[model samples]
Target: MAWSADKSYFFMLAKLLTYSIFGIDARPVEVEVDISPASMPKTILVGLAEAAVKESTHRIERALVNSGYTRPVDRIVINLSPADFPKEASSFDLPIALGVLAASGQLETSLFSEYSAVGELALDGVVRKVRGALSMALQARANGKKGLIVPVENSREAAVVDGIDVIPVGSLAEAVGFYTGVLPIDPVPFSWDDAVEEHGTYPFDYSDVKGQEMAKRAVTVAAAGRHHLLMIGSPGTGKTLLAQRLGTILPPLSAEESLETTRIYSAVGRLEEGESLLLQRPFRSPHHTISQAGLVGGGSIPTPGEISLAHHGILFLDELPEFNRNTLEVMRQPLEESRVTISRAVGSVTFPASLMLVSAMNPCPCGYRGDPKRQCHCSPMQIERYLSKISGPLLDRIDIHIEVPPVPFRELSARTEGTRSETMREQVIVAREAQRERFGKDGSLVNGTMAPQQIRKYCKLSKEAESLLKAAMEEMGLSARAHDKILRVSRTIADLDQAEFIDVPHLTEAINYRTLDRSSWTQ
Candidate 1:
């Protein structure tokens, strides 16, 4: 028999469903296999398969033989449909092998219609776990798949997605048995409320720090407003400690936010084994030596970077001045847009980066520029040159700039518990509730991300507060952006105070946050 373009001939070809990951998304691919007796006995894999995908044939052959299935000797042609798109990952091994069995008349083709499978096959028929199981499960549900066949290790990750059965298979033999109705594997069980209650709590707290009440207060304001914060202080002034506890004071992650954050972590293979949903907010602190691509997400395939992993969470850049200037500058766009878009020659990928940027740095090169106890050894020119590494534009984008002075010996030795995270979180929840009512229940709009028009509409100021802002703007030589920032921060402060309008005290606190940029150290 010869191959023809006739529609009726398509019925003889065996096709199974699978998926390929494309920038944190799972795109459906049909594994279409055809065995032609007219051609030589060789297997040909098409549809732009990458090296990893192309190399799976040998593994699949051994897996099939070990799983008690015959390896097809006829001229086998496997075409991953949507032929123009590039396909990667060894997850194609299972689906291609199954398609081969069906096309060779060893298995019923109709059984594959109910499920879409993704897994890597070992030589002895074991099925290995692959990345992006959560995204694949979501896509499978969207496409009306009855279930998704995944490795046992990925069962929990994929099962978190509702409305689809996740069939956990430990080996190629088990997968075949389940599809053939000879074996039954139940969908993994998940209780959303139970998972949240178990993993939602943070181990650290604000009270864990000995002192620095002022820093704690400033951090509360920043968290309440979702504002970027920059803490300047001497070494060991508890900058890192303050930054680490910021998450404990933040509101817990909503279900939607958890799914979004989990998808990024899943796509990057960062999820721990057997972990289903990420209940707590993510806290990503990339080292200062990270590259621009590593910070914002870029590759030939354009995977999600540190910022994307920190979606709806915190991105702490400790020792901020040590980071490359270009790498730090790359954050300007994502910070403004709440998303990072990486454009590759193949395509463009946009990743969510709606996160709180918390960073820490020493005041100067010697790490004691403003310390009362330590003698300053660095020359003024050296201090000036060191501070210049952080450009003015970047500084202006940060909403709150506060100095974290060293804790006094008396304060450190005090047995009293400092401010607790629970107390600050109550304040943050109240302030966030106010923003929700003001911005509507959409949960996307906050004071820190307010547009100019929104600021004009919502930020009402008292006459005295207006006068104070004008004087500060003049004395500090603030830019138009800085002016809007003051208004936003003022609006947040007023919310924290439960005040309806911005008053003198609120405006004064907001104005003081901007003073570090105008400090004499820069002069």
Candidate 2:
């Protein structure tokens, strides 16, 4: 049970599997520990480890002695390979500790090669949760590892990743007992069906808003097709309310999407302890005072920004004009590419940012420019300056632009609710199913994400629809990008109507959404 010279290390070497998260994905690493009795009585951690691991060997020694094991009296060396890359996470602590115990003959274990382990260690030898446990489990499964040993708090999160066993350990002693076959451990239970049973439940619903049927319709279309939307209105017109409830009408994330999204959340350490797969789509509403780096993701070691956090979900910008122009402008590339690439001097990382951008802004600076109840106090210059903050190119990227009118007093006080989120959610689901069928083979997810090439193939228009779109383009001074957006929106309208072809009515309805393109707005 204690350290013995006969059972002690002669050819003492131990290597185990571990993982490191880079951006939103993970890569496997091998933790190798070497123990030499004849060398100096010191511990050294080498091979490009970060500052956090500088005292790792010392901590491992302390943890070993504290966990009722004799500390190795000889020299110690720990190396995490691939040695060329930077290792910065605290996940290396567990593997390093186990490797030392095995190499020092305190623990007779050979499961290190069969199982991957990731966790931080306390001086008292307790195993603390590490970030990206789910990501590590996935890497372990992909690399043909049989099982994963993680902190007890992370068992549920990593257990959801199928095809591998998850051994939850509470302390370093418990982990050593399991590895040495001195104790028993069970893998946690998690399933996809159990994760998605509570999908459509939401605290905010469309029925909460009295009037704004047009705004609801526009938002439904945007969700159905993954389109970006902009709502221009005065204060207290349900614009913010509508934006908040957009995700309620969206379908739950698919199994593949759930894994991908959960991995992203895990990598960022945003996932709560013991939480499994994230079935609900994310809805991120960042403040207007955010900077370019926070909005688009940039740092010494890059991190995911708000857009990436809102992946496969909505990014709502309320009071859009209040945001700094350059900060808002950072979204132009990700809007087109559905991904963000942040480059550092050492390396570059790319984060997925596929999301529905729903922004709301007042009609003017005073918030009463077009209100029938309130008088406008701002001059034309102030209005122009506020509107100018949002660039034309940026506006063109958005598919739908509509005005939210003030709700009537009777509508506000009426007991009878208008259309509810349940009704709209069903309709949106139907329309999205239609799009999934239409773009099944071409690899396009939604009409709004279609490129010009996919647009030419799937968004075919009838003659009547073509003529209407042409006249409206000329009258509104629409750009080519705007033209494509209208076509995409029109395609979505047809999908909503359950029609196969884009008819003239769908085209008219789509063109009507481009309210900012009209010359009267400028006048």
Candidate 3:
């Protein structure tokens, strides 16, 4: 390699790299920087870099100088290979800076070649935490990297990635010391039990709700089957209370599910300060004013939205009808597909959105249309208009629709003798286990998300159960899609009872849950 006025010296240096945490699959990105000093003093970064990545030049230069390194003033050009793909974020600062230093003969590249580096660089050369540290670590492991150097703040998140070495670095000097073998980096060990001990049931429990046993039952079934639930009730009727308890009754996420959930949270920069894995299922309650993009996930650089954040968890819409109709309408596809694909002129990105939807709304404008104690002030037309705001297609997607009446004074003042969340959770877990066993052999799904073919094959009904379902469907004027949902719910009910097949009682209970559709059309 010879340096000339027109041709710069070519040096091929290898360094460990990590991928961006923005996209799905969390693929590893190789950060290859070609540093050459031939022309007049200048630094050029050549790659498909967004503003954040382009700005890394200033951060890297300041960091290198502050970290006691001399920058080659000779014209230096750095190229991040696979240059066609867009790179965004400050996480690349440390890697790009290290690559430049190594290529410029300031550091040994061989020492850092086996470990991926990801962090934001401060002007003072401190390593700051970057979003998607977990995703980066996972990508490092997948790419056969031996270790990862991440910011201390993201150490816990990166530690969740098993079978990989994660080194938490506080500053550029610490990272340099580890790479040069002057200072050894230790992996952060995480214990699931310790995480559980610290969080403790997430500060919300089913026992907190005073009453509304029917709504609780509906939610229990919803959790067991992963069904979408809609609760119609007046204000302060414990609808929100019941919705909050839905997560407690659900089963804990499997290791794979926890990782997937963590990836989405990391991508959205929602992973808590010290949290590694999201041990508990997510509960995302977006406000009614949220846009369709906010709900489904979209940006110039696509990021996980509320529904994606709620993946493998619960998505609760407090005032179901209050949400913009367009916003609600956009969810119908993801509800059926378990994922959302947002297309932009730049490109298209898909995000997982498999979640149990728990929505609540008033029966009428006055919030007293069906209340026993409160007199209805709204007219029939007003009530119809209010209910009509929720599209039938959206209503149809909801597997269970229950009317949550105000809790009786006696029950509210009672000694709270009903089963606690722990007990109810045990039952729900048992039911969910049965569903997992039944569905695990084929498609990865619970009862609620089963396909029509799965319903026909797995939700086998007895003669009596078939007759009961037929009569109910005819009476309720249910659609073909609703019919499958009924059978799925019936299957879950049978599983809850430890029954092998759908029976009359299970069908009866499943039919009872479709109260909204039955009442709305029948009345």
Q: Quantify all predictions' global Cα lDDT against the true fold.
A: 0.89, 0.86, 0.81
Q: Model 3 — which ten-residue stretch has the worst lDDT?
A: 1-10
Query: In terms of TM-score, how similar is model 3 to the real structure?
Result: 0.93
Predicted model with the maximum TM-score: 1
- Model 1 gets an lDDT of 0.89
Per-residue lDDT of model 1, residues 487-520, tens digit only: 9999999999999999999999887787565645
Please provide, for model 2 over 212-269, each residue's C-alpha lDDT reduced to its tens digit, 9 standing for 90 to 100: 8988899888988989999999998888899888878998777877777778888888
In candidate 2, stretches whose alpha carbon ends up further than 4 angstroms from where it belongs are 1-11, 198-200
> Which tens-of-lDDT digit does each residue in 1-523 have in candidate 3?
3333444333445455667754554656677655545557788887678899888898889999989987766766766666666788888888888777666665664656579888899999999988888878888888888888999999998898889899999998888888878888798888888877765366777777877777777787888888999888889998877877677778777788888998888876888888888888888899999998899888887877888889988899988878999999999999999998988765778888889998988888888877889898887788788888889888889999888888889988998666467877887888888987887775358898887788879999999998988888787776777788889899988888999999999998888888776756324
Candidate with the larger lDDT of 1 and 2: 1
Instruction: Mark the regions of model 3 whose C-alpha exceeds 4 Å error after superposition.
Output: 1-16, 34-36, 519-523
> Which prediction has the highest lDDT against the true structure?
1
